[model samples]
Target: MATGRPYQLVVFGASGFTGQFVVEEVARVAAEDELRGSLQWAVAGRSREKLQAVLEKAAKKLGKSELKSEVNIILCDVSDPSSLADMAKQTALVLNCVGPYRFFGEPVVKACVENGTSCIDISGEPQFLEGMYLNYNDKAAEKGAYIIGSCGFDSIPADMGVLYTRSNLKGTLTAVESFLNIKSGSEGSCIHDGTWKSAVYGLADQDNLRKLRRQIGHKPLPVIGRKLKGRGAVFYSNELNQYSVPFMGSDVSVVKRTQRYLHTHLNESPIQYAAYTTVGGIGSVIKLMFAGLLFLMLVKFDFGRKLLIKYPEFFSGGHFTKEGPTEKQMEESSFEMTFFGEGYSTGQDPQQGKPNVKICTQVKGPEAGYVATPIAMVQAAVTLLKDKSSLPKQGGVYSPGAAFSETKLIDRLNKHGIEFSVISKPEA
Candidate 1:
């Protein structure tokens, strides 16, 4: 399908904060591919001057002085529809790093869908993902162009990791609970400013989110089967030996969609899923609860959100800022997520209070926003390019698991420093 394209991939929004990291990672990968002559890609943004500067800086950061010389820079803007359409016509795939995706993402996707260019983005915004499906799924399917969202740290690890865990089990996967633990290895690592701005707006726009979900309608449940649902409540988990709270992001939403897809379309057994962020102790859990309450109360008003954005550090958790982690910090930083599964095998007894079987699976990677995101984002694009047969036949807005197959992505991530492992399994 991509046979005639001059460029295999295009990194749009390459001048932004996360975009810079993506450019550098692309450059690094490009260097390794010079011999094979297979890494044909370009960087694009609204301003040629800014794009040039970012490319130069990325070249210096990678210690490859000629990296910029080998890379291409194109000018494209979301506000300029013709330029976006031109961009879509030029590449087989577009990796969009532009975020707070509620505003700018749709038009670019529109351009790509019409032009039949495959698109992937590091968007964690649930509203954007759902709205795309509601508005553009049919168009993308008609054009044979796949559009995948939340491919980065937001939900890929959680979504794909769940499927990876399922592979190791023999019985039906009735339930899975994932717990997240992250630690910055050094001073330079941090949450990006884009994530901060997006979180603020995403929380504030609850009405639109509900409307979009309504537009998509719910996936039907299987007949005569155990139902799948997201876990409720914040509580202590005996499995991890820590207090946990519902993860305040799009992960649950993405994983839930994936499970629904598997059940309704693929006819796979349903899975009950839940995701959480761990607290060191009960005191931290109380603080988190109050913080969430304060956040909910603030998002109800425009002025309150502005105040929160103006002073992000007021809350106890580390604040998001424009500065990202240093290269050393990026490489050193890591994220670890442990998934716990408890359910009986197929045809096993179901009357007990809790199933006897227990399993633990883990997914780990480096520098969530800065490091792992770019890796996952780029890998998703490349996988879509090289492994077309592994994808769903029809193109639509899809979760990572639904769009890309598990073994292919897991192998890709493993080669790039992310690891998915079965930490423990029930005995024979």
Candidate 2:
């Protein structure tokens, strides 16, 4: 129950497929004691009709038909700047799900920062994320409003998983080789169009991503220790005994930002980060290589890019089309991320050729795009509201680890299905 404001949280894309989960999550949490006095929230989108339908269905989904009355609906379109400003002024927090963030993400962020309202999104777009930092980070800091991107599965597990490993390490953290594994329990599997479209758009615009990085001014590396190594964007890891390749997503950028933030601002040592996914057996590796090559061409060539835009479903193996994933598909899928790390002993003096320690950790969660995203976003929103004191006093654009503590989010994600646990530790 928010006092001065009518709502504690407002979901801006409540009618979209991912937005429904966010709406439902807010409703479900409202039924519990999480709502301080009364559940005060609103679902927003361009269309009132769709928002109404989602609000009504969300009540049923929560198993509390009467909860519909407690929930409210508001309409705002990303296309209109004033409308976004108005919405930003009403709520203390906004969970934005509408994306290919590079296209539709900035205005809402601008509104929130200007209004001094904190914002969170499940964005995996590097260009958009880096742009926010370059354009809005200072203004948001002036306003004391934190704009945290990649709150969802895209980088949460990656960023937080590294934090978990480092926290448990008795050594100076040096390197993290992260791996992504996906599994589904239902009859069929699809990555959902929202996630797919984000990937394709990001692929086609790699140069912009690099340009943004330079504009953002790459953070200085440690002066006297092992600097991060970029052996290749994609490579195989012998430690994991699996053919690993670059994640080809925002996970790497997000993870690195978190590390950079810590190094620059918190005086923590910078640690190198590498991200990958398992390709299963030999046959699947060949298929993955073909798919990888196809994706490279799609992004590198205008002709191939046009085909992707026109017939995404055909290229996406029917996983992405005009419609998004069904509730069943979202429900039946899950993902896991494992971290293999090496570093020097924490108490020992820095040395060049000696990374004598190793540690293992993993984060387990439900379907990344759907099931886990809502929980991650809501938890972040609630934590910002509840734990504002412990957070960075001067707000700015930040990665998850830099903005919030491992304990604050790790505890919340653990309560849900997204959990972080240490798998192994170096000897004493």
Candidate 3:
């Protein structure tokens, strides 16, 4: 948050698969933007050699010869409190790329908060993200350290897409339904096993998340308008002409948290939201059903989980692999999330009349898991550094929307790669 730190930011898991991409993004952004070029940042991990290798690889790929020498490497490990503390003390912010986060995220968070260093992560695991807020929000606020989670492909597009729709509307926005479409080029797309493992464990532990929420015990947000209806498990979306299913990512929980924050803290009307992802036509829907059933059954047991993790490609039907997607596959893949919003026209009392306004907006970007994930993560970090005054006065745990809604995050993202656009003008 200040200039006195030895380094302004640190990518804490620089040797991991996604961490490498984050390193490249920081390097690329630094080279392209004059302000970002001035960033004093470092890469951190248990192995300095591996960190050096990541930097070297990034240097070759990004064609930035100075990256290897310019970027600092910090020796930090999740298991080593002193190392984490040391890493935390040296940086103003830590862009944590370590995940499945339920296992490795807390130590970095604890260290950052204790040191008054803000931290961010691309974690999509709902239990971990919410648990951090319940456990650390107070301490983080007391220490003036912001702990923000899900600053990545998982929910940023969905969460911020809803915000974009609300901001663009000329009336009081009431509710939104987002349909996510991921498109792949000839090479096709697949994600790493890390994400698959996280999903497996997260699905396995839903009860604990429910228990954690009960422990938090905040009052329910007021429903300002007609309740949004659910579209059963699998359904055909006539709008997009694709069969869709409920998204399994963190968007619903994250967006709802943001909406709650806005309604409670900012005195804004809360928006009811739902998220779904397209799965092609009826055949794909059937495949999805079979896969979903098997996944649900398998994730419920420890042995089944191990099998799922050990054989991700097989279990996920080639959607997840230990080796991850090829660069060509990553290059060819992109995603679009369309938000359909309904609300009352300006000056209309929602309690008195049926909604009369409608708007459609979209957030689209490159390959979701690796490419756009790093772009969003790095841009969020840049927003933190460059737009401090736009943030909440007191630092605390926050969702991307809660923390960045008032910031120029949408603009920054638009300028970078992930674009938020109004597809249809507000209509009454």
How does residue 248 of candidate 2 score in lDDT? 71
Candidate 2 residue-wise lDDT, 1-428, digit = tens: 12277777899988887888888887776666766456577888999889888878876676778756766767799999999988988888888988878889999999999898888999988888989999998999988888999998877888888988888898788888888987766656676667777787787777888887778778566543455465453456666666666787788888888888888778888778878887566776777677677877776777887777677777766757667667787778888899988888867665576677889999988888777888888888878877777788788999898888533888878987788998888678
Residue runs of model 1 more than 4 Å from their true location after superposition: 33-35, 186-189, 220-233, 315-317, 326-332, 349-354
When summed lDDT is taken over every stretch of 10 residues in candidate 3, the lowest stretch is: 30-39
Q: Could you tell me how far off, in angstroms, the CA of residue 104 lies in candidate 3 after the best superposition? A: 0.4
Model 1 lDDT per residue over 25-133, tens place: 8777666653246778889999999999998898777788876687888899889999999999989889998877998999889999999898999888999988898
**Regions of model 2 farther than 4 Å from truth:** 1-3, 223-241
Better of 1 and 2 by TM-score: 2
Question: Global lDDT of each model?
Answer: 0.81, 0.80, 0.92
Q: Candidate 1: TM-score?
A: 0.93
Top candidate by TM-score? 3
Question: Positional deviation of 26 in candidate 1, in angstroms?
Answer: 1.6
TM-score of 2: 0.93
Ranking by lDDT: 3, 1, 2
Alpha-carbon deviation at 262 in model 3, angstroms:
0.7
